[model samples]
Target: MIIAVIDGMGGGIGGQIVNYLRQELPSYFEIYGLGTNSAATSVMLKNHANKGATGENAIVVSVKKANAIIGPLSIIIPNGMMGEVTDKMAAAVCDADAFKILLPISPENFELVGLENKPLMLLIKDAIDLLKKEFNIK
Candidate 1:
């Protein structure tokens, strides 16, 4: 399965998702770090995403080709994050039948840097468990 991690700036949330997936589920999954800008993409690349892209258009184009998408729900909001993640981004993720794994958005995390998406850690494990059970991972 190809999972795309979408993000705008910083990419902390997206990168963390990749990290968890890579460490826990490496059997047949490919993680793509999809960023709306170069900065976001750089962060994800460092986290070891199999592929990376930047810019709204670029992200829309590439993510449409991915199998699944994982990130904060805000990433797909229309004109969101200064247009870094536009409606097109949202469409691409959805049209692909890409199962979405989202991190909840809170004022504290949105305003603070490095606050981390605590729910992501929880969701990743549970999501993987469900996917594994459904697909028979082991």
Candidate 2:
């Protein structure tokens, strides 16, 4: 299966997701790191994503090829990631046929109510658990 991990800014979140997924998922699964910038892509790549791409166009094109998409909640919000995420990118992600596994992390001025404010690592672990359940992974 192809799983796309999208992120922007420092890409620390995407990097952690890539690293965790790589260690947990079967070897046959492919992880694609899609970043808003080259530096973010590089971080995901270093964390062992099978492939990497950057920018709006890359995200638009690559998301269609994925079986699942995982990232921060901001990835689907227009002008998110401090404006690094474009409307086109947000639309593309929403329109993709892939299942989305979004972390609760949001941008400034955005609030997700009723959800526990878990640490990033715990949030990521919850995402992985959801993915495993969806795919029937052991």
Candidate 3:
């Protein structure tokens, strides 16, 4: 499955998603990074994204091409936090009929685990474990 992660200026969330997918999916899922700028793309590419594209159009294109998408639920709310991921991207991901595993973070969820500064590796592990039980991923 092709997995796309849409992120903002530095691709922090997107990079974490890519790393999680790589460690947990275990089937060589094609990872694509959709960054709002060059910095975001660089982060994902370094973490081993098969391909990457930048800007709004690039995100739209990834949404069109991918089989599945992953990110925070707030991504659904366009201007929620990351200006890169707009409502259109959220709608596209939802409407694409692709499997999505969104983290339970929301706009009002005041405590955010900053992907850069925090050890989200354990969080990702726990989420994937729960997802495995729910979806039987292994």
TM-score against native, each model:
0.77, 0.98, 0.74
Which predicted model would earn the best lDDT? 2
RMSD of each: 4.7, 0.5, 4.3
Decreasing lDDT order of the candidates: 2, 1, 3
Per-candidate local distance difference test:
0.71, 0.97, 0.70
The list of candidate 1 runs beyond 4 A from truth reads 106-120, 130-135
lDDT of 2 by residue, 60-118 (tens): 99999999999999999999999999999999999999999999997999999999999
Clashes of each: 1, 0, 1
Best by TM-score: 2
1-138 per-residue lDDT for model 3 (tens digits): 687776665668778877877778866678888776789888988888899888766776678777666666666666655465677766776776656666656565455565433355665565567656655668
Candidate 1 local lDDT, 39-130, one digit each (tens)? 88888889888888787677777766666677776775666666666777777766666666555553223543574556666766766665
| Window of ten residues with lowest summed lDDT in model 3 | 109-118
**What TM-score does candidate 3 get on C-alpha atoms?**
0.74
